[model samples]
Target: MGLFTDAYDLFCIPPIMRLIGRVYYGDVDDPKKRYQVPIAITSAMVAIALLGAVIGQLVFGHLGDRMGRRRVLAWCGNWRDYPLSATIMSEFANRRTRGGFIAAVFSMQGFGILASSTVTMAICAIFDAASHSSYEKTPKDADWAWRLILLIGSIPAGLTFYWRMKMPETARYTALVEHNVLQAVNDVRNVLDLPLRNEELPPYPSPLDYPFFSRAFFRRHGRDLFSSAISWFLVDVVFYSTTLVLSQLNDQYLPKKENMNAYQDAYNVARFQALLAICSTIPGYFATVLFIDHIGRVKIQIMGFFFMAIALFAMGIPYFSYWYDHSDRGFLFLYGFTFFFSNFGPNTTTFIVPAELFPARFRSTCHGISGAFGKIGAIVGSIGFYWASQQNEENDHSNAKRITAGLVILGGACIVGVIMTRLFTHETMGRSLDDNENDHVA
Candidate 1:
């Protein structure tokens, strides 16, 4: 649910940005500047949440490790719950199902994206009906539409707060990190609803208490940490760049500016986003859930990155001139595949691997560290791409060419992801958390 809220809040902004522009920056005298929100303002509005996320991930991640996952999770706000969710899922799930479990939790992001688009579309439709005036003629109606969409994001966050508080501390954290054998056994017994056995339980393994920055810890997990962080960073660069720029892409596919009013423009953009999520994003997440365990994280991530690169390059390279001159449908098809492979590949795997590869004591912290890097990538992608897109427009570059440049850069990032995944990551499939944690000890 937290992940759901995260996606909703983050994604709902793009469609409404034009509405925001119409409300504040609309210029009736100049057609080109009419609905254009300044690039600086647009970038700031989109990147602010992601900037906050980087800080929140680091702070909450460390808190989850030091204080306890359940306590930290309950105390932290919903938007920063990614690392905590990954850690808790990793600790609780069995080895055979761990990848799917964690991936399943993250998959809520797809629904969140879908919901944001759907809700925005509904709100725009409602306002369009109520105002009985085109937004271009009376921009005030757009004000209400964007606000209602943003407010709806808070609902899921509020609904999940109590459940977060009620969640039990993971047994792995209690047993391995806290070294509380009896409490851990009881936690497992209660969760499983199993009869308590009279037989003695095995002694808990001695804690590997290396500090996160210590040489011992670095030697054990340095490669995995670097792998996870860098992989996440690269994927997010492409993921967010493509996502936040969809409005610009939609503009190309949409009918001519003279043909539609502002309300119709906003509605169509939201509708297109919803369609993309339904056709590509949601299916990709579920595909990961189905295949992640069978395929292994490393293989899936490498495959995802590789294909994402292929799809992106197809849209950007040899076909760039063709796309610029030709069918929007052909371009959108390849574009959709990038989202598909991202979910089925590195995006899901990066989140899962960090949670599993680290020791119980440092799991949340490492995941947090990794997630922070991803957010940094998001910030770069959102702000950087918007700036680039604006620059292209200023230079009289066609929207197609601007989008092509961004796609090519994103493709390069995916290629780098492939290399990094191949070099730095390890397969965690069917391996116990304890086995992964202790494998680097010697």
Candidate 2:
């Protein structure tokens, strides 16, 4: 649910930005500027949440390590709990099925993205019908539509707060990190409904307490940490840039803004994004759930990045002119595949890896650090792509060339991700978290 709200809140902004422009900035005298939010304002609005996310991931992530995952989560009292969720799920899951379990937790993000598009479409349709407005004229309710979409996003977060507070700490954290063996056994027994035992147990061994950033810590985890952080950073650069620019890309299929009202334009963009979520994003997540454990994280990530690069380059290079001039269908097909490989590949694996790759003591902190880097990438991608698109329009450059350039950069990022995964990361599949971390210590 945290992930669901995160996706909805983040992805819903682009569609509403159009409505916002129409409602507030619609009266500009300059034809190019009319009904468009200024580039500065647009980029700031899109990047602000992601900027906040970087702070939240770092602060909360460290808190989770220090205070305990469940306690910190209750205090967080909001969405954007990716590190906590991944850590808890990874700790609780058995080695054989850990990948699938963590992937399932992250898969809620796909539903959240779908819901954003679907809800926006529904809201636009309802307003259009209620106002009895013609598609040819701007709707007076554009402001209300965008505001309502944002308000609805808060619902899921509110609904999940109590549940987050109620969640028990993971047994691994309770036992290995906290050295509370009896409580850990009780927590697991209660969860699994196993019969209670009256027998006393010996105390568990204390976990190795390596200080973060110390020499021993670096010797054990520096390479994995670098790989996780860099992989997440590169993937998010491509992932977010593609997602945020999708509305603009839909302009090719949409009629001129002058020819249609704000509501109609919002509805069409929402519909197209919803279709992409359904056909590509949602399935991609589930595909990872099914194959991640079997194929292993390292292999799946490599395959995902490789194919994402292929799909992106197909639309960006040698064939850029052909895709742009000839077939909208072909362009969309490649676009859909980029999203598919993202969820099936690095997006899911990056989240899962940090949770298992580190010791229990630093799991949340490491995951948070990796996730914060990913958000930094998101900020760079959103601002950079928006600026590029605005420059193309302002300078009378071809939109196709602007888009192709961005795609080429993203494809290159994915190619680099492939190489980094091969060199720096290792397979976590079929290995217990303790075994994986202990091997590094040894």
Candidate 3:
């Protein structure tokens, strides 16, 4: 389900961004109205997704405890079946090279969208720039191009169909939930290619008595949820805030005055952003693969967030200074760092950790719960950026003030994330499920 969800969402991105841009700026030529609409819709959609995810986490999470993990995961696959094709591609390699391969899959998702968005936005640019003399051909040609891009982009999602039909449920999930110690043992043996003994089977929790609300369960899981939620919140807030501000900054300060058509300008800006995202995200994943194990998740998260804080501040200085003596180059550097570190930073772990840490019964719920908070943070960041930008534009105040506020808030949130991760999350590297806290190995 995790694999499927990741892949499906990746392909859906270009359309999502296109829809967002449409809502945010019906016509990108107008800066004042540009971000407001898109951010507003973004806020709404995220709010809804967050709400549904939280309730789903609570309900489905509890159900996972009552039902078997395998059953619950299978059910979740209804929404989770999008990434199998990519996951299968990653699964064949040996362990040493697997991370690189899987990271490539993750990275390719960005590249796919970058390519799609680039072409889509290019069409928009061409249409927007067309003269009245070209008016008769403009609409038809632009529509054809957009339809073609959509058709091509949809291919990746279609590719997952075959794999989705054949993938088996995780054997570990079956073992833990069904309490069939012998079957569980055999399942693990099959995957690991080792012999199994009944004596070696793990002890199972009492499925008859669901323990979701019990003090023991809360004691073990509550702190994790809080920590995951807060960390996700911080990541989303800072990440989206910086990304959006930087996008707007590009056009505002670095206006390609040579290009005067509004649609053309927006298309170029979007294409530029798509390229930047691909460039930064691919490298970021490699950095994660290389350093995540070596530095440890705790250190990687802290370093990533802190580095982002520094970059945010660096960008904010000039923003707050009213571009006092320089151009938007300083701001662009900050934006670039934000994009780079985002994929390279806690963003990766934040998503992966929630899935890895929790018990199988609650994995999706916890992931969804934490993911919900992340969405809230994304909404806040989007709305906040729009509000600040609007205020700055309306009152003729220095863009610096809003940029400073955004950066300061993000820095503080990063500091909080570092603290939560250090205090709450246990070291999971190479640790068996039986060894982790709550001891659900059985």
What are the per-residue Cα lDDT tens digits for candidate 1 across 1-442? 9889888887787778767766776656677777778888777776787889999999999988888899988867655888899999998899999899999999999999889989988887777777765535444667777888889998888878888887889988888777787788888888888876624555545777667889988887888889999999999998888888745755668765555555666777778888888999999999999998898999999999999999989988855467666765878888889899999998889889999888888889999999999999988887888777777454554655776788789899999998989988988899888886566555
For candidate 3, give the lDDT. 0.56
Q: Give the candidate number with the greatest lDDT.
A: 2
Candidate 1 vs 3: which has more TM-score: 1
Ordered by lDDT, highest first, the candidates read 2, 1, 3
- TM per candidate comes to 0.95, 0.95, 0.75
Q: Write the per-residue lDDT of candidate 3 for residues 1-442, one digit (tens) a residue.
A: 2443343333333333543444334446766554234555555664564455445544554454456444444444322321222223222334344444444545554565466556667566556556443222223343344455456544545554454434444554565555566666666677678887878865755442345567766777788878778888889888766654445555565444333333444455556656666667557766877765556656677777878877766666555565534674655666777767776777766655565566655555566667667757866775677567645455445655766676667777777777777887655444434344246433
Task: Report how far residue 342 has shifted in candidate 2, in Å.
Answer: 0.8
Worst 10 residues of 1 by lDDT: 196-205
Over 134-165, each residue of candidate 2 has an lDDT whose tens digit, in order, gives 75455787888999999999898888887887
C-alpha lDDT values of all predictions: 0.83, 0.85, 0.56
